[model samples]
Target: MDSGETKISLKDAENEEKEQFKLLHKYEAEVPKTFEEAISETGFGRFNYTLLVVILFPCATQMVETVGMTYIVPVAECDLHLTIEDKGLLNGVTFAGMISSGLFWGYLCDALGRKKIIVYGYLVTGFFSVMAAMSTSKGMLMGAKFMSGLIMHLSKSKAVLIPIIIFFLFVEFHAWNVFMLICASMTIISGILYMFLPESPKYLMSMGRNRAALVVMRKVYSKNTGKPQEDFPVKKLVNEAKQNFTSSRVEMATALKSGWEEMKTILHRPHINNMILASFNAFSIVMSLNTLKFWLPGIFQSISDYQNNHNGTSSSMCVMLGEMSKPKNITSSQECSVVKFHAWNVFMLICASMTIISGILYMFLPESPKYLMSMGRNRAALVVMRKVYSKNTGNPQEDFPVKKLVNEAKQNFTSSRVEMATALKSGWEEMKTILHRPHINNMILASFNAFSVVMRQVFSSLLVILTFISATCMFCIYFARSSLAVTILSAAGTAVGSVPENLLLTITLELFPTTLRTIALSIHLTAQRFGTTLGNAIFPYLVQMGCLPPFLFIGIFASATGLLSMLYANTENKPLI
Candidate 1:
């Protein structure tokens, strides 16, 4: 009787434990999973590697479009009847477009969607690029280039030397138009490729399309894991949308009001100082980099011209510039013409083809899960993460451990549209705030730095080591005995100068809160483009003044900015706000 009672008790305990596990599993099924929990389930895999490859094309095309003009200006000078001033205008016009359009594009990217703007923007930019290639007159070309810059504001540069090599190898045969067409074609290809890409999962969630975002994540998981969508572990996701805007139409008044509020937040106390520092640094670096870079080929061409005419004779940069500035008469017999099978034409074609390939490949990339989390679409974000986990670890989705994620701050906004006049009034009020007290001081400092960096032509030895090296190199170029020495020193200066441009941008990114980061960067880029435009516009005048003026201008500004950089608080391990 005792043995029978013990057996019965053990059986009952075992049954009770099994029943409890069943209840736990059922409860888990009903609970919504967080983005972190979902994403943790997905492992790293082939999809990530593929996404990286696709991103490379747009980057390459941007470089080609911006810097290609540097090469073309030199070769096309005779054909286009370009003077020193005309060359400066052409080189700087692209940046002028960028400066004007940066904020506009940023606004659209947020309101519409990043992928949409990028896609349509690239397509339109390509058309403008083609217009630039076909332009017969200086004004027409400038207009076209400006348009290209306006549309192509999204993307930058260590690969400065590529166009120089390309020009040398190809400009001997083909006209500049062919190269422009090649760039245009690349933009078109990038646009087409962008069509296949999914909208940002975060953007979808922000718009209250949780189910759509989930579908996208499921697709990504399928691609990454080669698994059926039905096999995904999570049966449902948590809804995180804070506002549901019902209207498809967006009013300018509404947009303006919304934008003004965001701008006020960015211009507020804590971020103002960093913004000022970044803007100044951007202006200094871009002005120095582009002004010199745009004119480098011209300098080299002048040197080549002198060597050809004065066989075996050596001269300084100042002497060459002075000689080139003197008037020369051209005869009808000197008419410019294009040659066949040019190397530049071929190289541009190759670049365009690669861009197309990258665009096409980019279709496979998934929306960023982190961006999703930021938008409070934790469930959608988790789905993306799980896909990644499944692909990376080659594990069954159900076997993934994490079942929940922490909730994040959700985006909230009012749906009621305001009148245009009210929006304008509000915007003006916000703008006025930046003109006051603490903000005003930093703004003045930034302006002063930009003005001094662009207008003053001087150099000093006391600065950061790299900038010092760059200054020393510039000084050395004036006294360089051989073409090779000038080439080496100029190249060294250019490479060294690029380091600070990247560093300043990186620091700027780390200095602001997520809400203000994009705006700060936009301001930073606008300052950079302004610097580029002003520097290039003035460079020819400086050259006319003397070679030393231009070199001194670049070297001095570089050093001054380098010194200013020392004052920035260290951000190495600082957490993002």
Candidate 2:
């Protein structure tokens, strides 16, 4: 009887142990996963390195397109019959196109999908770029370049100096068309390669295609991990679509309506002040940077011209520019003088090929998992994270810690179409918001600061006259006896000038909330582009008016803006909303 009792007790204990095991498994299965938790599992490795390489194509292409004209202007002056004003127009036109189409592109990116827009946009830009290369007349080139800018928005960087060096080496070729062709080819290659890239999983989820998003993630996992599709850990995805919005289709009308509503929200209280300030700062910095940058090749060319004619003469930037302002007699018999630099073609070719190579490699990239989470495709995001983890750690996908994802859909809106009248009205309201109350002072300060910075570039020569200005090295540029000294001073100025922009951008980022950060940045970029356009457009006229006017004009503005910066609220250590 005692032996029977012992057996029965042992059996009961075994049963309880099994039940506890089942309960533990159930809890583990039901545990929800957050995007951050899911993504943390993916360690950075081979996938991230590949992504870094691929994204560089867009950046390279943008540099080639926007500044490519600057290189051409100096060499093509004879062929294109370009004047100072015409050069200004050529440089500024692209930005004008960008500004005009900025909102439209933003809406289209939402409606169509980022991948679609990027691929097709690049192809169209390449076509226009080729057209620009083939243009015999200024008007045709201008139109082509403008169209390129209108279509191409994925474009900036310090790497601009690399192209400058390349152009310098290649300037002797005097093959402006060839240069343009190179730029076009780079853009086209990028567009073609973009075709092989996966669409944004977030966009798919936004359109109520969570399963499609998951499929993309799984493919990414397989590629990153060198594993079969069947090995991907996550098999199920949560539905991210709103109950009433079950369709997987997105219309232009829907996008526009949503965009306009979002724009309105961005322009309202709490955001207005930050936006205005940020925009103004962006305009100033970009304008200053581009105005000087676009004209740099021309400036160097003029210096070369001056030095060639008067070999022993040492002069200031004003002297070179002053000589450039003087009218010249040109005859049909006069040969088009090209800069005779060595190995320029090779460098330019290298720069061009780099873009193509980056594009081709871009084929290996996957959709952004962060975007997936935003679209409420948590499961898809988790899969991507797992792939990243396995690739980074050389582990199996099943070993990924997170098993299920928590829905984190942030975008929810109801709208069908947008009307032209509504767009205009909303734009006006946005402007009003920017100009209203506490924000107005911020705008004024930012605008003044921007204006000041650009003016500083224009009157950089004014360092000679303003004894109070602390930049003694800049003052030395005017007095420098040798080319080497002048070069050093100029390099120093370039390095120092870059600092203010970084500070202002950081401040802008710190002052705004994450929700409005992108819009604020957009505002900043738009303003910066506008500044570039305005500065380039006016720079030629300023040069023509006389060296002193440009200097004085910029000097006073810079001085005033420097003071205005004093009133700006300190952004240091301030938490973003």
Candidate 3:
């Protein structure tokens, strides 16, 4: 062969190999994968634990905001000389505030960033809360309470403050003013702690900040395992970033436009129906729980007074060092004196303190990687995975399932412009998709569940009242008084009935795609606030209409909710969109 022919032959061979490699890369990119698949290899570790811990404060604070009023009215009655109207206003005002602002915060969480809303929201909530504590007039107190609810945006979670609420009711510490101050302090503490937490990686990537996401992952890994950033998977992250980072530049206006459209999407298709159902369910749960909670102190006070009168144990009217008067009873036409209990005040203080501690603990956790992946920042997701893998497996990022995760994310690699346009357009299309055939069935099921949950809450409250009435009947029949028995049973029954209430949040989170999750939740919570306010406002009227009608009304709703469960979508083990 001639030298010229040999050189030409070599060049052709090299070119062919290069083309083959490109073809191979394209083929591998088509393989389907998910964020969960990538993250699963990381194993649950310090990252998750810390995240859970940090989230606990927001959860606790939320509970305090919703249920705290129950404790406050009883303790503050003496100092503030509260009227029944004033107490009712206080109970509903926080929820009213939340309902009004929930959409605003939810929009921001989806548009700008989750961390920003959370940090600033809590700080402002704290400031208003302090103003509420220092108020001397009912009008000032009501205004402060309204403002507190307006600015605060709380995260949803279960099992944070239930035990505290129950426990504080039994302790005696007369300090309502101090407790209010403490609740305010917790809000401030959570805001400060949140400042240290990482922004959601999904949010960062969606903004085209791949390098920043990688840096956060390294920081998390170093903190968890005492491992240096040098050992982190820089190469794999960079490669993954190449596949995921869609636009070299994500315009602020474009991103905002996209977010506004995404927010609109939840109100519209497959998402809209589910979103409606979830919101209704939220309405039911919050309304029922708050209605019962706010009404309890008043009912118990009446019960204690009635029992004391019949038993010939004159309830204390003057403040004694160790003695507590039975709760005062008030009728619409009768004038009532201020009544206070030390134990109830102390309970409020303890709950506020615990919430503060929870905020402090939450300061250590990382942002959710699932959120990061959704924003199209696959590299940032990789960094989080490496941290999880290093902490759990005691291995370097190289040993983690980087290839699997990268491959999965690469499978859905649409260009930035196309992706944004699709998201914007998706609002109407997704709603249309949901309205069609099988998906619509799920929406029907969700609606039924929501109605049932709301109705059942009413029933639960009535059941307690019925139990008391039954006990009263027994006492008259056999002269066998069991007031203590009735009280314990009612409290226990109410607590048990509320056990599954918060799971709605988790279920809603799982049911919706990441893009629509926050807005859906926000809508749900806003609906809940509306329900709570309505329930609290109307329960007095319902009671006036007669006890049996209220119970009957709730019974019908609960039955309907149970029947709808039969049509549920059976979403178990399904991959989130």
Candidate 4:
């Protein structure tokens, strides 16, 4: 009888355990799956637009340094007495600096934060740019250029800088030293403006500073919706902070150790292959873009020289500024030539001034929420989501689903540390993930596309040169005339080469998960720098072999990149996984 009673009791306990598990699962199901869903409820608002514009400023500055250098070579050639090798060295030196520092910067940005690196980068880059401007000799300028590249972050400074340089060159302000100084001043102003900008809320949360991230969100909400900060989600954020810590108290040393291990995860599984593909893409793009950008001025000079000789025209036709309207300050009877200090300085000043204004305006921009969530700063991430929703709909904080967001944070982040540990331990698994299915094919395709694009650009430029050379040799019977045709062909090739530059980051970003995003980007950028350095070194030597070989060699790389593109998955419109 006693034995029978004990058996019945055991059956009852099993039933109780099953019921409790059912209840737990039901509760979890009610929670939201991800932070992005909450963020989507926040209407895309002016704040986002403003952020984009602000971010674009750095891009402009980056462009200025990169593309502007090419323009500087020809104009400064007389002043600095640069040879062909010197010009190639100038073009490639900055990339070398970038290669050395890109991985380091990426690692820091991932481990520490993005804002600090970006702000500091601008300051250091500007300082070096000033050094370059004040350079008295070729060696000084080359050193300055390399340092500038090493310190500077990537962006789209070329578009504006190019026009400005051309205009200045046209106006007889071709002195590279003064132009560089002007660029440096603008960069410094930009850095100062970055100081006022808010840290990325995502970065803060990743560091487990949910409350601070929440505070940032509240400020953004208040600024956008004109609402009082009285009804803040303090409870939600507090819970999120709690969830981020696996232990009630993790030591700083332990956390940092974890973070280091976390960085090493990029080399594992799905991420490793992605990293490789991204790096190769970067290499291909940088090679093509820098090769063209750095060589444009030299090509133009060659063309101008050829035309001047063949046409027996004392006036120039091939220079960018020469084609534009001359300033009224110069007499109509005065001979127009590439002046050492053109009115283009005013344009450079204007461009720099505009970038400064943008930097100041961007101070209002917030951090990326995805980055925040990855760091297990769910509460902070939620706050940003709420702000997004509130700003878009002009609604009070109460209207949003705060509890659901909290639940999602709890469920998703409950094992964040465990996941990190898993990622660190299962590096091979991650690699396997990347090597299979959609990712593998995509990587293969993208790599080939990149290879082909670069190769085509290089090959086409050389081919164009050859085609023009043969045509001119057969018809015009003058080497100088052939030089002008080849130079123009080079310009066209450069234009083609740069056309695909804007797509690199977009595609790479969409492919990688948030956890590996920054590191992947760093790897990509580093590879690109390497490629650029190689191209710069090789292109000059190839040109020495009489132009045709350079294009053929470039064509081979382009063909490879292009073939890779065939396998590239359309990441466009796909959500980040």
User: Which predicted model would earn the best lDDT?
Assistant: 1
Q: Between candidates 3 and 4, which one is better according to lDDT?
A: 4
TM-score of each: 0.70, 0.67, 0.56, 0.57
List where candidate 3 sits over 4 angstroms from the true fold: 1-52, 110-112, 152-174, 236-282, 308-483, 486-488, 499-520, 543-560, 563-577
| Candidate 2, pairs of clashing residues | 42-389, 43-389, 169-344, 170-344, 284-450
lDDT of 1 at 300: 78
Q: Ten-residue segment with the worst summed lDDT in candidate 2?
A: 462-471
- Please give, for residues 56-127, the per-residue lDDT of candidate 3 as tens digits: 778877766667767777666655667555667788888888777765564466556778888888877876
Better of 1 and 4 by TM-score: 1
lDDT (C-alpha) at residue 319 in model 3: 15
Tell me each candidate's RMSD, in Å, in order: 17.9, 17.4, 16.6, 16.4
The sequence of per-residue lDDT tens digits that candidate 1 reaches over residues 273-355 is 77888889889877887887878788777787787779858687677766556543545315654444455566667676777
The CA lDDT at 232 in model 1 is 60
Question: Where does model 1 exceed 4 Å of error?
Answer: 1-27, 40-42, 152-174, 242-255, 265-273, 323-328, 331-334, 337-463, 570-575
Cα lDDT of model 2 overall?
Answer: 0.67
Q: For model 1, where is the 10-residue window of minimal lDDT?
A: 454-463
